[model samples]
Target: MHIVICSSIDFTPQIAQVAQGLTRLGHTVDIPLTSQQIIAGELTLEDYFAEKTNAGESARRKIEHDVIRSYFEKIKMADGILVLNFDKKGIANYIGGNTFLEMGFAHVLNKRIILYRPVPEMLYTDELLAFNPEVIDEDLALIR
Candidate 1:
């Protein structure tokens, strides 16, 4: 299976580990672009998120760089998307705005939705459940 990983950039390191597991299982994996850059030492986490400090600048950056659209393209070509939903901001199994959007894209595209953890308690919990994601609970063997 060809898989695209969706998660907060904070999980960059863990994403690499997950990619390795998927590879071991004979699956082709693609990590988030930002995470790849950070892991490659070409970009820093802080720098990638710096524009987020200003709402206007963030919006501009997203538009100018085609961030969302590019990810949508990746999702469109993938067989499935694996969400690495680790805890963040005191929320267990956190799924931030971008990851949520990516999940929605995969669902509408009829792509498999895999979650590394259980559904999180958030404003979008109901919507997340609506996606009917398959939870792996950190077991890569269960990816199918």
Candidate 2:
């Protein structure tokens, strides 16, 4: 299966590990760029901070628009989506924006929706359950 692994850019390591696992399972994976990544090739973190400190609101908005446009491009290429809610920070939070946007796009495109949060404790939370009550054990089977 072709899968698009989606999660926040700030959580790159977790997303990379999940992507590797999915690839090993014979699935093609496309990972989305993180927010910081738009300028990563051109600017260091310090440079971004410096720029943000000096740039006008209009410039920041333009940067955000570009990042969002790049995100849409990735969505167009995905077949199925995998939401990585497995957190490296030890804080049990829902999977981030990339995954949610992917989910919305997959829904519109009639693609498979596979929400995989590896932390079992977090999985049973009201937050996730509420976000997607239709998800059942059959979906969970895909992770293995």
Q: Which residue pairs collide in model 2, if any?
A: 9-34
Q: Which candidate leads in TM-score?
A: 1
Query: Tens-digit lDDT track for model 1 on 74-142?
Result: 999999999999999999999999999999999999999999999999999999999999998999999
Against the correct fold, how does model 2 do in TM-score? 0.58
Report the error of model 2 at residue 43, Å.
7.3
Score every model by TM-score.
Answer: 0.91, 0.58
- Candidate 1 stretches with Cα past 4 Å from truth are 49-51, 54-61
The superposed Cα distance between candidate 2 and the true structure at residue 2, in angstroms, equals: 1.5
Clash count of each predicted structure: 0, 1
